[model samples]
Target: MKSSIKDVVGEMVTPFLEENHMELVDVEYVKEGSNWFLRVYVDKEGGIDIEDCGRVSEFLSAQLDERDPIPSAYFLEVSSPGAERPLKKPRDYERAVGKHVLVTVYEPVDGLKEFEGTLTSYDETGLAVAIGQKTYRIPADKVASARLAIVF
Candidate 1:
């Protein structure tokens, strides 16, 4: 159900983001306590501001009102993904090269499931991350999740 909502929200926002020269980071439908929240994460080359988020929220709100894909009441939120933005696509990884990141694999790589360090490079096949003196080459298929990491 959560995945379905995310997909629907993604579909509904793609054209709006493109038209506005923005990029869709992620969409999440989650229940917190008794409230349901539909969160939309967006970004661009220079990052997003409050105005950008407001515009997206307004557009998505109207669309949701018209379609009413979700049956229950929910609050809509649009915001930047922040410094620890998730790397959700190949382009994201490629753009993340030279930045700090945390990657978790579906299975252990070198006896470990998670690696955190600087992203040295990324290509079609895999990515190389340098954790101090050691570097791990992780195949793209093995990655379960990846996101930017704050070194501090």
Candidate 2:
């Protein structure tokens, strides 16, 4: 692949999102049965609405149409990441401090591969997740995936 279709879309979408004061959460290109899908996740400070999604979808659709990066046809979808939004970047982790989160590590930390609790702190060292009175320091490089956890 030539830098990946997802990367291309990201490059194209970043400027548009930045101009609108929105952030790009993720971009996914996948095949579901006989159909292909290009999904774009975007968000803003106060959250986004359907109108925002529609605008992003339209903007991305036009850019993709002009670029024609993908050889096959694909449905384009733009939407929010919702309450369980992923924590992919440092800024995301920073914003997630004091919130409930679920983090899965590449290696076990304190005999556990996953941790679900309130994120007390996040820094260059990694993250400090408080599971009740206990806190685990997860190394930055050990994080496989992390997302906000919805409280019941």
* Model 2 pairs whose backbones collide: none
Q: lDDT for every model?
A: 0.95, 0.94
C-alpha RMSD of each candidate structure in angstroms: 1.1, 1.3
| Candidate 1 C-alpha RMSD relative to the actual structure | 1.1
Off by over 4 Å in 1: none
Q: Model 1, 116: alpha-carbon shift in Å? A: 0.9
Candidate 2 runs further than 4 Å off: none
Error of 1 at 31 (Å): 1.2
User: lDDT by residue for model 1 over 48-126, one digit each (tens)?
Assistant: 8999999999999999999999999999999999999999988899899999999999999999899999999999889
TM-score of each: 0.95, 0.96
